[model samples]
Target: MSSPRASHRGPATMFILVGFPGMEDSHFRLAFPLCFLFMVAVLGNCTVIYIIKVERSLHEPMYLFLCMLAAIDIMIALSTMPKMMAIFWFKSTNIAFDACLVQMFCIHSLSGMESTILLAMAFDRYIAICYPLSHSSILTTPRIAKIGLLAIIRGAALMGPLPIFIKRLPFCRSNILSHSYCLHQDVMKLACASIKVNVIYGLVVIIFAIGLDSLLISLSYFFILKAALGLTQEARVKALGTCISHICAVFLFYVPFIGLSMVHRFGKTHGSNIHTVMANVHLLVPPVLNPLVYGVKTKQIRHRMLRAFCRMKSC
Candidate 1:
């Protein structure tokens, strides 16, 4: 009788995150830009959250959704950045299996939450533009809170089992993750056992989370566009203007994500550096850009930010 650990399909205890395959010598060079972007992301998202919290005027459904988006972006960034920085700057790329799974959970779950929030924002815009008189009644504070809670629960329920399933698989292949951070596909590739279950589950999660959210968001915008077309030019512009920030945020969130997915399933045999860089971009770019997009495009948030700056300077 052999020990359970002696079995070929037993669990792996740890994994090494390969920051970049052939770019190890340039880790120092990479750190400069990566660190700068990470700092910007952290500070930008913090500013967004603080402004939303402090400004009474921003307590509306639109701004509340923005607040939720910013928070999710922050969590997604924080989940991956420290470990990535460690890998790049200090060559400390090894991670415990459980820790890697936890990181994966944070990245995937928060990403799902962000997508859900984006959908909610789109719905907010739809109601405001298409049914102005009823917008207030439809998106009251209680309802908004419920939407947020449902987004969170949906993300958790979909992504929570991923790590557990991965943990059960024996990692006979190399424990080196292709990206600097933990991703479901990256981790799944290392398991020696048949990964059809993991692959199917991942695809299902993607279809339900990102796929469904994207469809609903797009549908909301379709109806929004239809309604806007019925109004005067000025009124149409006004209605469409409110959604510009959200539209940009959606692009920022989804484009890199789609790029990464395409490269993952199709470009694995391509330059490993390309894949790794895209993964980093997918994770880092959204958080840094979302707040900036909202801050610059949104008049209320921009004005409040400016006022806050002036008050701080005066003090």
Candidate 2:
């Protein structure tokens, strides 16, 4: 039998954000390192977006998709990091119910958008490498715009129902979330009522939306590999070289994801700190690393980023 719920509805209540369970005293120490990561994420992603926006030479499909990725990375960082820092630094754990839902929506939807952008990037590389002569005609500016629009819409539509479903649950059990920010799964776990709908819905979204995206990205890369194999060794190296940054970006995002999923499903004895560390790795590492990887690997972006830095120093 379920324990008696608190006699209040959930909407008006404030939920608590736990920075790290059993490690509350470590929050201040944790904040310093995490703050550095967040700063790098924000600055790196912003530089990528700014460089792409202003550089007409980077108006191609691949770079445009990269711009979308950078933007989504910034959004994800903004949605979670500030609140996380507040929790760690100021002990600001209480979040209004509505505000929590808003944060959840932003985090999940932006993650979905990021996943879609990654897939779009894979497709762009496939087209560029496999159908080099037709690349320009195939991925015109109009088509690229449409592709970006679809990513935004897909994210919004899929994650839109999450908050609504979560809102219907009675949250009388406990308000303490497992992480520093609001997540749909974390919030739903606090509810006294049945969360069957929310669980099934979240699973469906993860499978069809995020999961399918990764699958498609892999398929795109498979074709790209085949195309690359047909070329001479020198030509193959050049073609694959163009995808190095993207491959690194993909690994940064998904490898941690796979690791976290494994820990969640199989390592039940693991402490909450383990989960917290893994979750943050999945959530935070890509935003901090993708810009660096791309800027280092792509010569055009490297030159432009260096130029931008030189101008800033002169000012």
lDDT of candidate 1 over 1-315, digit per residue (tens): 111222345678877777777677998788888888888988999999898888898899999998998889888878888888888898887788889889999999999899999999999999999999999999999999999999999888899999988978887656777888889998888777899999999999888789889999999999999999999999999889989999998898898898899999998785557788789878888999988898999888899889988999999
Off by over 4 Å in 1: 1-9
Best by TM-score: 1
TM-score of model 1 relative to the true fold? 0.95
lDDT per prediction? 0.87, 0.86
Per-residue lDDT of model 2, residues 128-242, tens digit only: 9999999999999999999999999999999999999987887666666667787787688778778899889988997898789899999999999998989999999999999
Using lDDT as the measure, the top candidate is 1
Superposed on all Cα atoms, the candidates' RMSDs to the truth, in angstroms, are 3.6, 3.0
lDDT value, candidate 1, whole model: 0.87
TM-score of each model, in listed order: 0.95, 0.93
